[model samples]
Target: MNQGQAAAVFEGVYARRLDMIHRFPPGLRALGTRYIEPLFVAIGPYHRHLPRVQEMERMKRVAVHQFMQDTGLDWDALLAAAGVVAAQARALYDIPPAQNQGGDDPAAVQVPEAADQGEPQPHEQGAGQQEQNQDGVGPAAEQALGAGVQEVLAAGHHGIPLPPLPMSNAGFQEMLCIDAFFLLHYISMRDADNVPPSALAHLFYSRRSLIDNDIMLLENQIPFFVLTHLNELHPIFLRPFVAKLATNFHGHKSTRRIPPFQHHGYTPPHLLALLRFCMKEPVPAPPAPDAAGGPQQAPDAGGGPQQAPDVEDGAQAPAPDAGGGAPPALDAAGGPQQAPDVSITFTAIGLEEIGINLNVSDRNRFTDMAIRKRSFGPHLFKDPLLLGRELVLPQLFLGNVSSNYLVNMAAWEVCTAESYVERDTIVCSYIRILAMLMHREDDVHQLRAVHLMEGELTDRETLDLITSLGKHLPMGERYVRMLASIEEYKLVTWFWIAVHKLFYLYFKKIATFFAAIGSLAGVFKAFELVLVKKHQ
Candidate 1:
């Protein structure tokens, strides 16, 4: 048979063998083993003998590692254990003599039956010794004997002769094996918190093969060929592959440049959060203004109402400003161009639509926790919430930040974002913060200036802003600490204390006023009642 035909036949036979073996009590409980064993045997010989099969197997192995890593499996250690088992098996049996029989005359039947001259054993030993001198059994012979014993044992237990390995589940196993390698490659290539873009890109492309192979398709349409049976495989062996991906893709970018907004300090935490919300998913514009036309535009920073853009969504109307107010800040020339107009668009795609619930904790946490354990940290995978949702798309944040604030905050400003831009400008916003903290010169002073700018913020507002910004900025923990420090500082403490005292005094006055009003009302009511009674 040609290789493909051989593969097909092998697969069919092995699958049948697996189905039969799985009927056994113990093997049935081990999970995936029935399929695994036959799958291995079917492909193992072909992998060794056929060049095409070998190449595909290698690719499959790599792809398996990658898939396992992505799925958060410990593939490396599992494969290592498998390797040890295979090596021991090989040492014990060099080559099966039965295999040498080559699909021919029923494998040299060695039916153990009574020998006719068995009673003459005493002298037979001395004769057997002489015979041993003529033909000494070596390791190879011993191995053959061992194989014979094993087959007999197997037959006794399984009630069937060990069939030639077939390729029943080759496609599935091959995919898993390839996934393991792909995962390993990514694990090895990872540097610090950042995953190599090339690696991400490569894995993304390689993943298509799983679908192409279609060995074990799932109802969900997610290729389950390898990962589908993850629970069936040895988790201990699978963990390392999962861990490596986690460690390698940590939140902070040690080498890459942070993106523009946070790097240049154009938008503070609040505006940044708003900008992020806008960039998350594109929103369809409000439906073209009705026949009467769009709502009236507020006066621009230049003191004249500018025409609003036509909206395409009939349901959404932009919130009207209370007054025709000017934008937040003005340029040196007092031009309207200096102020950024903040517009947020939210297109609601239901939770089911994405197959991931924004509110569900465990499901979201599992993917992240698995990655984190591998040592990537929160920075590797951004998790603004403990249970992560709202994945931080760096490109979107960067693009929006740039478009919104470049002119307002120049590169020369001694601002947080400017410093980031000075370094790697292509990296994500959070990564820049991490890099700055780790490697920047005059870090304390730079951060102090940023802190000064932060002082204008209210406690509730500032806290919310910082937390939201943490979703995308690699320096989430750092920002959290910095804000805590600001709260603890003597000036901030005094300010809070003064505010608290003022609140106490104000409440006291209001309470006294209410008491006085109550007394007057009571007296007035008594007087009115007495007058009415006298009149009656």
Candidate 2:
């Protein structure tokens, strides 16, 4: 590597606190690039040269013109404003020297650095107008900001020498400015009632999924700071846009579950980061089980042979005193709650085969998941009905579009693994958990039966997708913790699982035979009625 090039590589790997935007690592890319690489459009330099995505350049220009018209800013106003933040934006992306397309060219990019990366205005200004530009250029900002058409990149410890952008400095600024426009216009037009007058908005309908997929790709992001900066210049309340997103993906519950995007309270490095935050928002624990049909108590809890609290993974639960402490406790309805004798490795069907049934979670986010105990029927009959413990999973739509978002988000998690603590790999962890549960087509069927999984993807396709995604993810804390939780649960409840297994494997067939006899009797009765009518 040239001295400058090597330095740039150093900056990406070692210089910054965490370089947030990145090219998804090729190691993981081996898993699949269908969604990793842009399929329809390119937002940043990473995939701008793809021939298929090249066609979308005109659309971006169209977005630029529309942005100019909507903001009522002259080209020079837009250029200068966008130019100021360019350098810092550039730093977040690690363009290895070989791919430093903008190598040695001076151009810059950056965005708001504070809450949602903005300071609250004591008073409101005109739409899109900012009283102060927190994004105003600095020594760091100048490092990446190109000198438009006039100035060549001056030699100094200016930020990483600009990649010789396919767009010279001026062209680079134009790309950033217009890319912001594309994202902004897309959001504003996401509303159903907006009824886009032009074909541009109409095009979104036909290509909506592809568009969503493209913008959200880990490699295909524009800095969120740029979005914030542009919003400062041209104000658009994104409430409606986010609301539609909530309604589309989640149910009509609206923004109740979705955290709103604001300028002051939250800041994202880019769109993917924002989405990661949204999807990983912690799901509240289900209300504590009431004593009536509530969960059987554990050794750690007040009551029975249940999972020990905070037990280390793979730890063995001590055997109940052979001397016979009081027998297992009774439920509210006086049903004997069976203590598990032993536990088994689980699949989705295995859980059902034993007793824990899958159920749909209340929220729409994939990360909004939990293992809950809810009373599905009479306490006396809970085991027969599969009513006690439930694995609550959110509905994954699992179409090309959702798949696109998932793979890309997981890709982001994998690529940015070191930048995050183990708990932060929510998406990757969630996907892996699903793969663990779903061992085959029957497992996918179980998810479908409860609406835990949905969309156009077939059962096989769904299993394939989850399997592929889960295979490549490094085990994150969330995944490990979940496994521990399940293991601990099994260690404590083995007796209960044994009882259920016996009844299900043997007694249930007898029960089915009796049920069949009852059905046969009903059929005979109906046939008698028909004979009488014919005689009459």
Candidate 3:
């Protein structure tokens, strides 16, 4: 080979060497792939423009690869299989030199440093430094950098370069944020039993650091991490934590056996499911501004700023049938005690047990209960016949009537019934059912509560009942609003309808029996009179 051709071939081989970069640690693999790989390619051709420095970068890659392999990580398999470095080399070589893109200029592009190579050195160059080439430029001299090249270099140094390193998308970012959120959500939550608390704590701290500092990583890779941790977190541990959520949160109300969730009045099943998923997963910290003008931080974790304790003192026991009767009397110590007037504690539990989507049996049971009027009967005001017992009231009503208007109407109907025993059961059950239905990833319960409380008292039956109850019962000032809320749900109408229907049926039965007895007496008297006439 000619001297120049032989020299060019050797330079190319040295410049494309892949030793140094292959020696990174295992933990740095994802980081390297996400940030460093693209950068190597970007500067690869430029290095060739200055052959010696390009060779140095190639050597760095080899060093990184070796460093990584030393960790004994399985990630090495990824590199060997992908041939990512080789592909990058091929890509770089395929692109013609900048000068070659246009007509060839007789003069080479001479950078300024080469001209100053004749000057005396102020200080000795560091070890491994290359001497000035024939062009008179020291290999260590800083090259003129375009803005784009500078960005790529910056990304590399910060561990966020492009190419073989995967980039993040909006969805991926959201998932990361959610993962972080759940990590905190699970840890901050109580009942740490059977959980690897230390592992979770470390994970939260790590994720929090990444979130707080705004570290870059592949968005798609986040799900795997989230699922791994989430699988370890048991759903049972969240129950007591959620129970505490109900007591402190204003809109949340306790249901019977099943727990309460955050309520956003009109949320659908799909939305609630998404919300539950978020609660189960890690919650992400807020995102910050990025150098690229993209979000620098993760999205806000969806929850209230003031999280309540997951447990409470003096908490009443869950009632047998949801909304069985009035709660027991409260003693001076602010605890529930047995009351003579109220036999059983009212619970909202039945509402929680009922499925969001009811089957035919659920519908039949609810319908039969709704029609039954006797308080002592199977589906009435008995302890077992609680508001949410037969079926989830809000869910049932929602299923039967397919509109917002119908839902609101049903809610009003149940709330305004006259029988406090019956009315409260329905109202409370409806509230519990609605909360389960509307458990959004974010707290949306207040909106639903507010809507259920709005509007003027238009229904005469409810208005009259509210007026009557106010006069007879020694209700406090708060009771006015409470009754109004109950009235809005149409509890009064249901109570009166049941009472009137039962009374009407009772009178009809009595009348029919009396008429039959009177006919029998008249027939006996007629027979006696005929016999007397025959004897005379």
Candidate 4:
């Protein structure tokens, strides 16, 4: 090869590094292959020609025809526009050329069987024609291409009215356009008044649960740009509607309210990313410096740092910097120190035993959580038990599809080098936290009783799901730090529980003596009332 060609190829390879759609890493796929595989339909070239999913291609053609007829545009016009940028679109997927090529030569192609020609014309016998005939481009594909296009294909570029394209190239681009239109239509018609029901009846009535799940698979996605470009040619209004539909569809009722398209800076790479964006919470900024120029101490959700009262009866006090401090120093040799194993020894039920209340919060995202102390009346010798922690976590809807959706998102975050450890670890951290909390089916039952998890899945299934997620992905540094914080928090919480129990024990005798005094006083008052009645 010439130097110029080699240089151009090298540059192209470098440029494609930032492509959004990616193949699943081998580790992730091994954990659950079905999660990444498309069930009902394939949107991109990655799964386009799979034997199992090819039936949907016929449905796509029918949907495309209906879409064009409804929108008042010709099929050829749409195909021409798609053809103009077909090469660009093809480059977006990671499919190998050999797989797409069925021995079709770009220089020549066949006339469709549906064409009016009775016999094999002399010019139609090229290598491309033989390849197309062998590939069996189906009745639906031929009908979609139409007789005019086939005639142009049979006639060489010299005499043809349109630009030359291989049958495979033409078919793939058509597939992309039709698939994108189907998605757009499905999303836009959710609550539209003017749109006819007949236009989307087939899609709405199909195996919706399976299709909905498939659309969010990482490998099954087409780039958002292609959908947008196709939208421009049909109806421009559907663009924003697509985003709104996506926001409502994936999370359903449980999703956090993300602002409409204009205010948000996030541009989703595909459907899965779109759903992930909807659930994301904006990270709070660092606290600003005070007027004296010292670093400001961040307040907890309760508006101040939580303080634990002094321990009675000579118990150990919790370290003031337990949750916030750096790791202990290494030994004299300056090597890494091996800290003693620290873990949460208590379960959710154990916390409840010490008077801690587990309540589910209204927040839609799982990462939203806060621990606060509940207060009681002052004059009544206050129960130290009231100081027990109230754990508030976001409500999650768990079901059959939840595992697939979550695992793929977590896998995407782990595989992409561009993903930020702190910002993008939301799903990963949430899953890890679940793994830490749920040791068995009983833990799942505890969470469900508090309304923290609401769905059809049983406790055993939930436990299994948590177990699977924890095993597959490597823990990030941020997650490690979070684990340390959780351990410290657990230690502090246990200390308070111990202190509260001790204080209750100490006060029990004084409370019993007071109760006896009150009973005697009541008896004396009743006797006095009886004497007064006799005198009257």
Find the candidate with the highest lDDT and give its number. Answer: 2
Q: How would the candidate models be sorted by lDDT, starting from the highest?
A: 2, 4, 3, 1
lDDT tens digits by residue: candidate 1, 224-262: 122223323422122222222221122222333111111
lDDT of 4 by residue, 447-500 (tens): 888777767678888888777777666654334544455555556677766665
Residue 529 miss distance in model 1 (angstroms) = 4.8
Using all chains and alpha carbons, the TM-scores for the candidates as numbered come to 0.18, 0.67, 0.20, 0.64
RMSD of each: 26.7, 15.2, 26.5, 14.7
Cα error, candidate 1, residue 73 (Å): 22
Across residues 125-150, which tens digit of lDDT does each residue of candidate 2 receive?
Answer: 23432222222222322344435211
What TM-score does model 2 achieve against the real structure? 0.67
Better model by lDDT, 2 or 3? 2
Question: What is the C-alpha local distance difference test score of each model?
Answer: 0.28, 0.58, 0.29, 0.55
Residue 39, candidate 3: alpha-carbon lDDT: 17
lDDT value, residue 208 of candidate 3: 37
Candidate 4 weakest ten by summed lDDT: 107-116
Candidate 2 wrong stretches, greater than 4 Å = 1-19, 96-168, 193-196, 239-243, 246-264, 282-345, 376-380, 384-388, 419-422, 512-536
Range of the 10 consecutive residues with the lowest summed lDDT in candidate 3:
106-115
Model 1: lowest-lDDT 10 consecutive positions: 364-373
- Pick by TM-score: which candidate is best? 2
